[model samples]
Target: MKQSLLEVKGLRVAFGDKEVVHGIDFQIDQGEKLALVGESGSGKTVTALSLLRLAQNADVTGVANFAGEEGGAARDLLALPESKLRGIRGKEIAMIFQEPMTALNALYPVGDQIAEVLELHQALSARAAHEAAVQLLADTGIPEPARRARAFPHQLSGGQRQRAMIAMALACRPRLLLADEPTTALDVTVRAQILDLLTDLQRRYGMAVLLITHDLNLVRRFADRVAVMENGHLIEHGAVATVFDAPRHPYTRKLIDSRPQRDVAPVTARQAEPVLAAKSLRVIYPVPRPGFAGWFRKGEFVAVRGADFRIAPGETLGVVGESGSGKSTLALAALGLLKHQGELDVAGRRWNAGGASDRALRRVMQVVFQDPFSSLSPRMTVEQIVGEGLTVHAPELDAAARRTRSLDVLGQVGLTEAQFPALLDRYPHEFSGGQRQRLAVARALIVDPKLLVLDEPTSALDVTIQKQVLGLLQRLQRERGLSYLLITHDVEVIRAMAHQVIVMKDGAILESGPVGQVLDAPGHPYTQKLVAAALAD
Candidate 1:
């Protein structure tokens, strides 16, 4: 029989007394795509990092045998010396982390970063590295590669940065690639493209891949084998088709059952008026050309064009689109943050285009951005963070009153103010990704807003936590008679919450109707393509 490229026997990883990865075993043949899927704190990332001896401050033990001529005969990855392990990092194994914003260097140009990897792994000169980097960028579908290569990490969009990460990981042509939630934060369109790129690269290079993710949609489409993990245990493992179609373990079955489906409930009477309305909304910017020196000239760019929509009370209107499709642009415009030509109304009140005195509307309309870490202020305590809006609107409340109110609201969002005082007084980095998102939701809820604009609120969360948040949102809408204008690329979230669905592409509305009708018989080809892309597996 042909030898496996990588094998694990009774592998275990622990941090102090807490053992995160239990004794588990798996093997991957050459060119195989194996997915490690589970909820947050399930130890998937820890296990993936172990392959390259990359676990951060953790004690790992087991037999990790990297067979083939490349892995230096017999020394296990856990037993390898630092010098020997350093050589394997880029050349033998590579990883594309989940958050490119945190993983990438903000100060450096993306192209230079990719070039740095090539120079480190291969004997490439400065000039040669530059050319190779440009090719890599172009290969990853970055338009205007040469110009984009010169741009810093902040200049590019989220999808563009993720693609740049892929370029860097593949630049080394490693024997094995570890992709940890590679497309979790990407838009559906960009996610599909990235998945395609990885598959194509796998075929072209014949490199074994360990795709660590919670996205079952990705697993069905791309993975060869699926391993289900729960609380640091491998619950089940089998062929991708079998596992997805007929998951044996209860946890795995629960995961499959939890996947959102198109709403079958009948639409009810629209009793309440729309909380938010937008018509002919257009946001345009005159960007500079490639060779231009200044941010001038008629580049003829439009972020959002003629975006017309409404979110009624007690209903969720989902804006579904890929990255750069102007979904967030529409949200920002509705908040009066961006200058645009449009008619906007929130809770029967006309939006003031003067960008002044949005206090009344702010109280009625609140927003939850994608990244809670960036959205929440680090310096302020949880009381200040959640009560800032309340203080601005109702300044009569003193610090003590505000703290009491903040604690009450935090409890509403499944967080105990007493048990989580560390979170209340601490910074964004102190809380986990899921906890931070819940805090963001709590802040929005503190305003008692009639309408909430949730822009990819659960994109960064793990699957189990995502389900909890979705359930919480549904309950909030029912109890408070609240409305939501949910902007997301996640089809599942839309399925779970959206009463009305609007599909947008290239700043134009592709289709919009009742969720049942739109999802069942999509009228527009673009909408059909989106549904197809989402349900591709």
Candidate 2:
């Protein structure tokens, strides 16, 4: 067997008085890829962070032995001094965090940030470090590396920012790379590209990878071995294929089987009226003109160009695309939140630019945003959140009636007073991600809307929770006859929730048809590529 690059024995972590990660053991061999898979709150991330002692306010114990370079003496990372640990951090071991936007320094240029790592760890000259940063960016498939190097973290797209983070992590050529849900926030195509880049770089540098993620598809595609974690325990560990093919643990099997399922039966008749309809819709924003032309006229950036689609009552229409593809713009237009140039009708009424009619239209159309944690107010209680829509649509109702309505709606979304005694008084932060998303759904449903615009509704959820939420949505649609305009980058979500589908790219529709036709046998090259990438993962 190959020599172990890093080995952990009886690891444990506790935050304050709560023990989060119990004693667990695993090892990564030289130049190998190991995936730690689990759902949120399963202690996957906590376990990884314990290796580097990065989790704040947490107490860590047990041995994390790392084989030093050139057959030097192996060091117990858990017992290392802070001074020595600092030396080993970026040089001997590096980490790529989950969210690049927050992980990177917003005030500094991304290139300078990478250069700083090289200077600290590799002790290179300023000029040499800067040059190396640019080269590293280019190696990670970033375009216009020199120009991009000078750009701040906010200036780059999500994919570009992630590439910059990767460049910084690899600057010192560490022996082990700790990637924590590295592609979780990325678009599907960008995710595939990042995975390919990591795989290529791992092969070239001959480094071991400890990938922490809940995405089983990613583990199947990228990892050589898999270690399954569930509620702070190591439930299973073996070769990737062996564990995936014959998972001994129920949690592991559940994770592998958690792919979204299509439960909404096809509508046979066309009896219901269209809840939303759009014809040749166009949305444009005025961008600053570059060069001398800025003195005269602003440039027109078309966000949604002549897109046409419709959603009937109780039917679901999915819009799939990458970031900056204008799918969210279309959702905004459909919700009457944005001004558009073509014919867009909701509940047989057109948007009236914040007039009395527009206020009425708001009652007929409600939206559930992508991230429930941010979308839901932290200061607001569950009762306040679910009942706020009633203030606008049913202002005449008394406080007691509003409370009753809120409770009823909450029950409809699978939350009840029986489940939690203080359900209404609880805040968003008090709930888990899945519970928060259900609350978001309840808030949207409380308005008695005919149509719901779901923007990446399940993108932020774990696979199992995603399945549950989709099931809730399906049940709600079937029972309430509500229509949905689902916007997301996940093909599985689209397949599970949508009856009809439209594939978008660069503010234009490349393909539109029944979900079966569009996704299974996509005619457009872009759609084909998307399908292939989803299947590959």
Q: How does candidate 2 fare on TM-score?
A: 0.89
How close is each model in CA RMSD to the real structure?
Answer: 3.0, 3.0
After superposition, the stretches of candidate 1 with alpha carbons farther than 4 Å from their true spots are: 68-71, 261-273, 290-298, 350-356, 377-384, 417-432
Q: Which lDDT tens digits does candidate 2 get at residues 395-479?
A: 9999999999999999998899999898999999777778999999999999899989999888667788888999999999988
How much lDDT does candidate 2 score? 0.88
| TM-scores for candidates 1 onward, in order | 0.90, 0.89
lDDT of 1 at 512: 93
- State the lDDT of candidate 1 residue by residue for 1-537, as single tens digits: 645888899999998898989999999888899999988778898899887777888889999888646544755887888998888887778999888887889999998998898888897997799899999988877878988888898777667788888888989888789999888767776777888888888889888899998788788888999999998999999999999888888899887766653333333536666788888989886766655545455576798879888877688899998776788888888887778887888888787734445777888888998878778888877766887877877788888888788888888888884766554576665567778888898889887888888988888777777887888787777778888889998876888889998988878888898887888789888888888877773
The most accurate candidate by lDDT is 2
Q: What is the TM-score (0 to 1) of candidate 1?
A: 0.90
